[model samples]
Target: MGEKLKLYGFNNLTKALSFNIYDVCYAKTAREQKDYIAYIDEQYNSERLTNILTTLTDMIGAKVLNIARQDYDPQGASVTILIAEGSMLPAGETQLAHLDKSHVTVHTYPEYHPETCLATFRVDIDVATCGEITPLSTLDYLIRSFDSDIITMDYRVRGFTRDMNGRKLFLDHKVNSIQDYIEPELLRRYDAVDINVYDANIFHTKMMLKEVDLQNYLFKTDVYELPPKTRLEIMNNLRREMIEIFSGRNIY
Candidate 1:
């Protein structure tokens, strides 16, 4: 590790990481579709999401100051955790006022296309910090925690901090691309793209799974149960959905 630069004061640079993952599956009948949505809701409930965020807080060596979590009535859940660099909290300061800039949040959306028999579960997460810690280190863990078919991430560093001599530093670390922080093994599993603005200290990466296993995308059904032609159709539909999502455009 390079010698740590002594800062004049608290690191004012706010590094924010936001990403969303999509899990696509084929549920044949209406009943199966409903079940798939229900399954996703229960699997990623507020309690479980809170645990994930808490683990992320620990991973980044931050202390959680407060948390607000709720589960929706029909489906989905949301969790937000306010964190600080360490045990430091100003006396008599409100939790939100003191740590509003540093927090982690997650929300889930589960939906289905009855016409195409496709069920999709989407999870959106955000991690922001304003000190020596960064949220980039938790990227791999977050990706691994979910069944991700397509993923898109945005990372940005805002504001500037001063050094010991009062020199402004926009970015404390070197980051040409967000992909630089991702695990190589994980990179090999998906086709990734990067759109970065180096001058502004912003980076974006989008990934789509390279290979699709028939069994993995099926819900309460076996590949063998699908006739050869039906299997081909389902695979095509699934691929199309993923591509459309990855491209952010509807395909003809």
Candidate 2:
């Protein structure tokens, strides 16, 4: 018979041998010798089994070693088996197989942004649709649809915000310290634009002119009727700009 076998700890191995549970015992080759010595010292009942274990270790080209009881606990132990030379279990398959296959809809708590509407759609699809619509293509569509005066889109880091009078300001959370590279000229321009810093980490800022005058211009130009794809483009541009600014190497 091709060795009917099971893997276990030193204590179990000793017990199995003492009770003549199996014809042979095997252990990992890489385990420490000191561990094996310690295990032998601990189990008074298995003193006779030491010679057998040592012989088995040599036969299997494995070291006889001690292993703590904690190592076998639910959260502590991890078991992996190699089936053959080139074939083995898939990565993450063990955990994935144990998961219950049930649809669960997670709702956001009221404490978070109340106005934000977000949902995740889980689909087992082979390909993504995003690659089909490039960001530049989306931007081109938006620009062509909207009037220049009504919808002005520019990329900038989201940082400081100023009051209507341009005196009071708020800084973003991540901005640790103000640096000299943030030029006085830039500050002056920010003052002019009534820029207020909201979050230091969020790099991009999208400014939409929601006033009646701007809305009237958008209506007049017939650009307000742009598709959802065009709107998504504008939003994505802002996101990209933010990501770039946050990841930029320049510290100042």
Candidate 3:
């Protein structure tokens, strides 16, 4: 932490944070796969997602100007909130298409392998602010809101704000790595990697949970029901899938 810069005008610097998470599941039968999707849809529907974003808005110390939410056909949901850093917008002027300051959005995908029993629930969230608010403050809370096996995050500070003396400051605060903001307890559970471009003000971090328990990945099934060999095969397939996702490439 350092001394706050005295800005001449509204802090024009824009900081954006994107958080993405993957929850893997093993649904061995056709019925199980259907149930998995159904469960995901229910757990993260439009209503619940909106509630989460509302709490996030509070966490970042921003005011919600407007919100547009929808639950898609068959599956998935989307919620977008237009926020303000200071005073609320003039009455009767609330629309997202013209918003350029602060906002929060969430998109969910309930998908499964075509030929395999592997299923994955993915949620992508973006929180961008233009004034004094910083999205990094809400990182841990957002991660804890989901059931994650793998987490990938990207944070970038864009544009510039002027100091009291009219000098342009690219970044208002100091941040060497996104990992620095993550809580120690959560950090201990995952293997992490960082690829950052400090000069450009962009930082990326990806993490994969270190421990894998078969029961956690199984859907509507138990380890005791499957033969020992089948259980081992399931565990291997799950591990391989997780590794490939964490590495962002296929394993040959």
Per-candidate local distance difference test:
0.91, 0.22, 0.89
User: Which candidate number would show the highest TM-score if scored against the true structure?
Assistant: 1
Q: How far out, in Å, is residue 71 in model 3?
A: 0.6
* Per-model TM values vs. the true structure: 0.95, 0.14, 0.94
The RMSD of every model to the true structure, in order and in angstroms, is 2.3, 31.7, 2.7
Q: Judged by lDDT relative to the true structure, which candidate is superior, 1 or 3?
A: 1
What TM-score number comes out for model 2? 0.14
Give a tens-digit lDDT track for model 2, residues 190-249: 211222233532122222222223222221123356576754553444334323333333
Model 2 accuracy (lDDT, Cα):
0.22
Off by over 4 Å in 3: 88-100
Prediction 1 global C-alpha lDDT: 0.91
Report the lDDT tens digits of candidate 3 across residue range 29-50. Answer: 8788989999999999999999
Candidate 1, 71-104: lDDT as tens digits: 9989999999989876466555544335436999
Q: Residue 187 deviation, candidate 1, in Å? A: 1.1
What local lDDT score does residue 196 receive in model 1, on the 0 to 100 scale? 92
Ranking by TM-score: 1, 3, 2
Off by over 4 Å in 1: 90-100
